[model samples]
Target: MKEMEQPVLSVRNLHKQYGSGCAACRDARRERLLKNYCPACGTVYACQDISFEVFGGEILGVVGESGSGKSTLMKCLYFDQEVSAGEAYLYAYQEGRQNIFAQSAQQKRYIQNHLMGKVYQNPLDGLRMNFSSLGNIGEKLIAAGHRHVGRMEARGRELLAHVNIPEYRVKEAPKSFSGGMQQRVQIAKALSNHPPLLLLDEVTTGLDLSVQASVLDLIKMIQRDFKISMVIVSHDFGVIRMLADRTMVMLDGRVIEHGLTDQVLEDPQHSYTQQLVQSLL
Candidate 1:
């Protein structure tokens, strides 16, 4: 909880447009709800004018209903999806001078391998189900250029244990593990390189309440142990309230309100945020 005067990542005026932009997109643009099909042109604006900053050792929560473009924004940041416009920079890379959006494929690959970790909503998206838990985490180390098999395997054991996954399961394929265990393996894989920034998208969405609690506890432990910055996307306020230091409320693909987690929860200014907080109450 030290003073975070510098941000680990900064995103400015980010946008993602799907389909041919036509006249209907104009209304979508005006309203900033460009994430859906345009009534006039049927263009899909998956994201528009998105901007945010994540500070070192801080968790920034992005909350919104499904299809609010929050997931699209995370995809853009992780380079899984392309952006139509705007810039994103990682402070840990090139001293925060390099724009991630403009990086060459090689440079981006290096960044992805060394400086970023992402846990997808689906374990299959983030992990190789057929690979053993150890192999899943080891792949990340290999990508980061760790060629020593012994060292990679050691790191894998360390990560799995750190995430509270039993060491006995290290050699088992994720396909054979339970849903929660698969998620733990995904988290361990994501953390293999000790990345400075971690992106989590709906990580607890489909889990049972007990499983969700355990996963959330594990994430909290990781955050404390690593002191890594995070951008967590979730529709559940309980998830945000439990983990985020700051929260951003997204509606119709736009951030309508954002501030300290306590402030946003206690004194929500946006109508949508107010409704969300009230629903919890």
Candidate 2:
């Protein structure tokens, strides 16, 4: 967290919308839209001028209610969804000089395969249900240009083991595993490329309380052990509190507050953020 150290991932003026915006919704500075939706043109601004930086080995948590654009932000960052407007720079890609959003399809694919990894909220979205856990991890390894089967298999086994997936179940497909196990496998696959940045979208949302705890613990462990910068999106303050080094609170597709986790939790400046912190009490 040194002032002179460059951020691992830097994003600026990120915006995403589902429909073409009208004059009423075009000028977001005026705040004319109703909760990110324009009545006249039916445009839904999922994210508006969202900006943030994640430093190396730091976890930046994004907490917001459903439809708050947090998940959309993650999708845009991971290239699962295209951004309407924005620029994202990764230190590991072109020395952070290139705007990732503007990269060519092939260049973007290279970034996705080698510089970043993402774990979707739904296991099905992140994993091939029919593929064995090792196969899933191997898929990522292959994309990263690992050609030797022996080396890839070794790396896959090491990652699965790191995520606490049983060796016996390495050959088992995620379809046969529990929700928690599937998530673990997804995480293992995401980590296969050893990407400097990892994007996780509501990873513990559907899990049981005990299962959520285990996954949270696993995340913390990964952060500590791998020292990879992460952007974790969740609606739960509890999850953010447990994992984030810094927190950003989003509302109506805008960032209302952001600071160190403790600062935001202890002295929430915005009313919406206050309500969120209160709900956690």
- Per residue, candidate 2 scores C-alpha lDDT tens digits across 35-127 of 989899999999999999999899999999999999999989988899999999999998999999999989989999998989999999999
> Estimated TM-score per prediction?
0.95, 0.98
Steric collisions counted per model? 0, 0
Candidate 2 off by > 4 Å: none
Model 1 stretches astray by more than 4 angstroms: 1-4, 27-36
Model 1 TM-score is 0.95
lDDT of 1 by residue, 34-124 (tens): 3466766666776778888888889999999988889999999999988988899888898888789999989989989999999999998
Clashing residue pairs for model 1 = none
